[model samples]
Target: MPDDARLLSHPFDDDKLREECGIFGVIGVVDAAQFVALGLHALQHRGQEAGGIVTYAPEVGFASARRFGYVRDSFTKASVIETLPGSLGIGHVRYSTAGSKGQTQIRDVQPLFAEFAMGGCAIAHNGNITNAVALKRELIERGSIFQSSSDTECIIHLMARSIQSNIPERIKDALRRVEGAFSIVAMTRSKLIGVRDPLGVRPLMLGRVGDGFALASETCAFDIIGAEFLREVEPGEMVIITADGVESFFPFERQRPRFCVFEHVYFSRPDSVIGGKSVYETRRRIGVELAREAPVEADLVCPVPDSGTPAAIGYSQESGIPYAMGIIRNQYVGRTFIEPAEHIRNMGVRLKLNVNRALIRGKRIVLVDDSVVRGTTSRKIKEMILDAGAREVHFRIASPPTQWPCFYGVDTPEKDKLLASTMSEEQMRAHLGVDSLRFVSLDGLYRAAGEENGRDDARPQYCDACFSGDYPVSPADMIERGFQLKRSA
Candidate 1:
């Protein structure tokens, strides 16, 4: 949903950046849609707007179900899963970065299927297409009709126009004309396919389940269905999974890989692994780095709950400050809860998190959080802590300030909407009305992610563009729409 409409949805999570989608697929597995549903449930945190599953079986042909809500809400029922029985299936949990945003319609839900000259294929995409508007215009002029507003539909139209002899070749042909990040899970009757863009701006993992195979946005999804963690689907690489086994190919011209760094700080489930590193360990290391960079005199280190808990533990362990859950999250305050009046709406974060007044009162508290985007939540949280009679509040952010909007897939506010874009660290501290505020440096973040030398400006390792404004791939659509890039230093 858009920022304004978030008040009606989940206002507690609005200040944070959100990844747009999560995809999972399985091949050579009986009841693949059921496996896909479990995978999507594990990945629900990445996207909660809607979910869809498409499966192909010889007897039933193709079956699809897309519903506007959680996977648990829609795909769990026997009525829905029975209709989608197949040995090859693909599914998506969506949070709309490329399409209609908050206005997600059933048509926008994915596992978008189409029949082509070769046969029928369905795709579940997990990233954004930067040149979609231009390609969409060209395709429309060339007589390609679009259904949903999703940029991923452009790939379908492009594949339709391609003269390629097969679906995989047509996929490569279509991707060659498109720009930006993508980690796709697509399925034909006999084949389940996975591919990542040249930069690998998003994550996709390959897993093994007995003799069959799985592709997921994270290893946590693999964990949910008892699949063995294999390796990541490499950047610029494609894997075709069938009854025989898996065949790998590099369909795109390889560039220096720039996987999204924010996945470690947020987005991915803590239990997930990326590039052989545990997301939880990376976040803990981030806290270690943050404590080393910015230590403060606080009685207790407290996490903002859930997202900040691991980092807070690391901070406490490193700083010798006892860790406590100062703010308790209401585990059941779902997005469906309605605050019908202005006053009720104003009680924003209070609805989701309440300060542990007994633990917080009279303490000089250190509140650790993943990142501060607009600082609205930070301000509200600080107020709550102060009202609980805390003497002072210090904030330690896991990631560096988000200074730019993400074009590759993450749903972020415009540059100006980012508090860090217009304010210095000290200014943000003043704005949040905290005793002090510090964010992990970009290099510090890189070090925590296993880069010993930290970020290499000459040849950077990962995508920290949200913090640094150094986009690995030019965002073609935004540039065309008149969004300015950061001037070189």
Candidate 2:
């Protein structure tokens, strides 16, 4: 195991921390690596920090190329893409939640490789593994060597030790041993396997292209490859694609599906379908419900930016208020801004979003946003609206309050930093200096999902832990253990 000292320090600057990871795998194709590269390009919105691809051609065992920047920067050149050749492949686009800024160099880009008694395995993962620290300790004690600090690497070690007869069985054994949210795509000599946790905390979908099969974190990837939308990979299920064809395995007894609700509200592309509901439709319905639940007399409805635009339209339609582009976002600014000093860091928000005074001047405005994580950005936006000559600014959140931290892939703040965790709605309203503040109710959020009981086919229940504080997995003891480990370090 390598000493990963950078993990102790915060690496990401404030501006570049808003995206999730994406994974793609393909089997039984002539140019699988090239096709996977194209698929990753389409799903680039999910992650932008780093990108890589690993392919196993008949002549070549496992040829891999990875870089510390965007997918286009890494593999778009003719020289880079043409070099990779394989019929089985896996790819990853990463946004670091594990290693620090120093570790974010190329060494951290994944499809982490490990060789064992059974041969070799390459894994690309899209979600966080909560029990990783504990698991890594156990593996290290057993003499397993680790190349990276990423939690994804933990699964490779687990698979190497399992007594299963084949790769799929070994993978199933490894999954049963680990815990937390993970939507993984792993490739071996002859197989491409996709696995999802029992709670289904992250989204993973299956698609078919001609005679081949594909697996990705979102359907948007499928759109790029012209693959027909097959159904989602069921929670706790593992599907293995080989030359023989596709085979499904349910290694663990089934558990309730706790699909991450945030995916529909914020993370996923609006055009994608998650847990059977269209992301766009769900956000629109959230707007409709927010208008019904928190109606206010306002001259116009203005969205915070890209993610809030759909819900703002819905709010306008349901409330009979006109929708206007009151705020414009500078799309060219790449997720991070250049700040020479600590005093100027807050200015990043201004560079990202601005108020169009002509549309908002002298009017009562209804401001819509997807979620308020820390409330700092929300507070700033409200003040900007007030300064733009708005008579009043009433804030409407499209989703239920996020009161709990997510142990899954979403890098949510600690419980103490969450605004809703400590303060009442009235307290939060005063803190933000808004004329009024209201959030969509939990029941209303489910209803807006348009499912009879919020269960769409496979997932009969939703993961409302952030709003309800009823986690599917026990986090009380885990949090204490994590804290103790941090103190020891």
lDDT of each: 0.91, 0.80
Worst 10 residues of 2 by lDDT: 1-10
* lDDT measured at residue 276 in model 1 versus the true structure, 0 to 100: 96
| Candidate 1 local lDDT, 1-489, one digit each (tens) | 456676555556778898989999998888998999999999999888899999999998999999987888898999999999888899999886443334666888898999987789999899999999999999999998898988999999999989989999999999999899999999998999999999998999999997899999999999989999989999999999989999999987879999999999999999999899999999999999999999999999999989998899889999999999899999988766664666767788999999999999999999999999989999999999999999999999999999999998888888899999999989999999999999999999999999999999999999889988899989998998899998998
Model 2, residue 393: C-alpha shift (Å): 0.6
Each candidate's TM vs. the true structure? 0.98, 0.91
Tens digits of per-residue lDDT, candidate 2, 38-126, equal 88987787777788899887676888899766677778887887778888899998776555444566767878877667767888888
The residue pairs that clash in candidate 1, if any, are 1-102
RMSD vs true structure, all candidates: 1.3, 4.5
Clashes of each: 1, 0
Candidate 2 structure lDDT: 0.80
TM-score for candidate 2, please give it.
0.91
Give candidate 1's error at residue 391 in angstroms: 0.6
- What lDDT does candidate 1 reach at residue 228? 97
